[model samples]
Target: MERTGRMETITYDCIREAAARLKGAAHRTPVMTSRTLNKQSGREIYLKCEQFQRGGAFKFRGAYNTISRMTEEEKQRGVLAYSSGNHAQGVALAARLSGVPAVICIPTDAPPVKLAATRETYGAEVLTFDRLTTDREAFGRQVAEERGLTIVPPFDHPHIIAGAGTVALELLEEVPDLDAVITPIGGGGLLSGTSIAAHGWNPKIRVFGAEPKLAADTYRSLQEGKRVSIDPPSTVADGLRATTPGVLTFPILQSHVENVVLVTEEEIEDAIRFALLRLKTVIEPSAAVALAAVRKGALPRDCRKVGVILSGGNIDPSLLAQLWEREATKI
Candidate 1:
């Protein structure tokens, strides 16, 4: 696919069209405020708690919106997708809801909790690949061809981008005067979509994206002024492990996003702990990227009213306990 260049020109009409398509399918996830967070950060924090979203992540919003628009023939043919975690659950649940059979291609090394959830909960067929040697996109395409399944890409589709945009729609509705908004980026679906919605509502609203430094594809892409691929992503944040940003999303991000900040594994761990201890939320490492950005001063301190999208809360309990133990040892 050819890269989209300078996406700031993306009009509100496109976003409105996406909003209309996503109506009733996507949840209007709530904007939650924490007085404790407010006191500590010294900023009024509005958390777009997408942890409460269907399939436990905001990915479902885009998945459903995209699949729901598919033709009846397409539905009968079913859908195929590749994801390590959140997007797997999103595609699975979306296909289930749309009454279509779904196949998810996942890394063999994917977290047991996420893989099990994708298969058992959503009733999707799971195909595992050796992360060390297998090419997921190629494998996914093969599966789609063999099974006559329409590929619902994790990001890159216009409908998917629009669907993802609804998160910011709901957030802006609840907190109209947000000084800035921060979200985690993988393939740039959520970041691009949210940036479009945020800028549509208020052009001055600062839009930032956070990434794990271990797998900072989007950050590198932004710096290079083009999409870049990370051949071997090594990050605890499974949801942010996409090798490259989508062509469509990259252009949108290049124009609208204020910055793409990278956070180290340690900072990510600290942010996860902060979410668990202070916010009382079990956020996945991917979701912790935004909070980590805030703690690292990646976001502007002058922004009094800030909105952070807690992308998901599907951490494995065993891993959670282990993370807590590690934190305890450091103290």
Candidate 2:
């Protein structure tokens, strides 16, 4: 695997290899269907339930795939990463399983449950940064260079993108005739990977992304024909708050993704409530973006079958309660 610098060229073969690497290690999460949802959306909807993934997110696939391929010396030296929540736990758990030490740099405001899971349950050394005040990427690089630790970024890396693609690979394999696929976008890894996999399976398969209107950098980037950066996002969907699309992931998106649908914070919360009350599942606001798009008729009326990747279910209970309580006042 040669790199052209910090990025490597990813191909469908890379994704297939990632799927092979994750065969026994990662769970083959279930694909769920809701009759009520299908009736409401007027489409056959298949939900890829990644909330049941080992780290409670799809991020574990990329983390484990990347860590498992590290050289002996690199493994001995360990790894470093910066993530708000899900990716932190993904890297920590993967490093732990590989018998490699890890240091994760996280935002001070990341969800308490996710933060505690990474540090306490996974037993990784945790570092905190003020997201508003610190350049976390630069800090991670300095720490990695000083300690000789490999940096496993949340997204951007070819391996991470390839691993994330396996989610769509599994979905398309299960439902071969999906008219389109929609996934929540943060740094664009999931959507990028999904685009590759869906097209590889069937070039006609439409790939779309769900983004918070508050942090729709990828959406704007796609419209502008270049990557666009937005101000630090204050969306309730913490995992979808990436300010910009990944350089590596952006190109793939430009070529492969059909388009991105933007949903408001209220829509995100409504989808979350729907998942909890109607689907009997708990999905975080980030994951609910896809569902919001579906329920709100973001897809074309002709599109009959849609596959949605429920990215994760790691929301804080208190936050969820507060959001629901605030919504109840309006009703």
Candidate 3:
């Protein structure tokens, strides 16, 4: 693990201000209750359904807040970003809403459904590169320089962290006495945001981060007492493929997050299937990490009130069919 001086740490006040800035721009996604989850887990569960958010993920809140806070000059130059799917859609839609042109750098291996949605629905320019050979961050920087586009990072930016904190803000508003809160971590945006909001609301509430075992950089980082990178991450959770934790999110997580738990790919798939079958909601693999943690006994058994952030719902129909068939065969 190594420390990078380039990263900016986000603060509780910063997140609060960012939430205020995103007041009308981002959706205050609902806190859904499930009797099935309660019975199965033996604890009251409050699911923060970010799947209902605009662009079908909590990434929208950060994107909109970050883009909206840009200078007029920055907006005039347009915006550029790199993402596998959710963040790409978030940045594209946010740019569109702000009347700014957007260019999204995507890996050639990105899901076809997500790529299509980003281009057709948001009208963003899609630039594809080989996932194995190309460095997306470098590509994004090159595009930004060439096109005069301001880079609105997916999770590393201060404004992005702040915007993401709003999810916890809304969640605690509905479930004030939550014993513990769990959220999936990618580049640490959502987890950091959740930490800020939960601790800010009530310091007694514990916040935990759930990560896929194959791409568990955050979990390793916390253990090593510094940031770590997991190159060529192998996992079904495409959205949590970030190799390095964000500079802005790491400090907040270190200060506020109580633990980081790892979930296997199989566990993630099972959680996704459980959400679809029992909750009747579509959740991406990354979003299901929190639920996977619970199902695997990563959370404390005595936690009376638990909150899990169900971060997104977008899934290719083919993948959905495959998952359903797999579940059926197992049954």
Tens digits of per-residue lDDT for model 2, 241-329: 78899989998899998889999998999999899889999998899999999999999887899999999999999988987798789
Each prediction's Cα RMSD?
A: 2.6, 1.5, 2.7
Steric clashes per prediction: 0, 0, 0
Hey, what RMSD does candidate 2 come out at?
A: 1.5
lDDT of 1 at 78: 93
TM-score of each: 0.93, 0.97, 0.95
lDDT of 1 by residue, 23-50 (tens): 7776777777778778877888888988
Q: Any idea what lDDT model 1 has?
A: 0.86
Question: How many pairs of residues collide in model 1?
Answer: 0
Which lDDT values do the candidates have, in the order given? 0.86, 0.93, 0.88
- Between candidates 1 and 2, the TM-score winner: 2
Q: What would the per-residue lDDT of candidate 3 be over residues 1-331, giving only the tens digit for each residue?
A: 1235765556667777877888888888888888988887888889999989999899999999888888999998899989999999999999999999999998877778889989999999999988678878998899889888899888887788888888998888888999999999999989988998888888999899999989989999999989998786878888998998976678778888989999998899999999998988899888999999987777877777999998898776787788899989987
In candidate 2, which residue ranges exceed 4 Å CA deviation? 1-7, 327-331
Q: After superposition, how far is residue 41 of candidate 2 from its true place, in Å?
A: 0.6
Whole-model alpha-carbon lDDT for candidate 2: 0.93
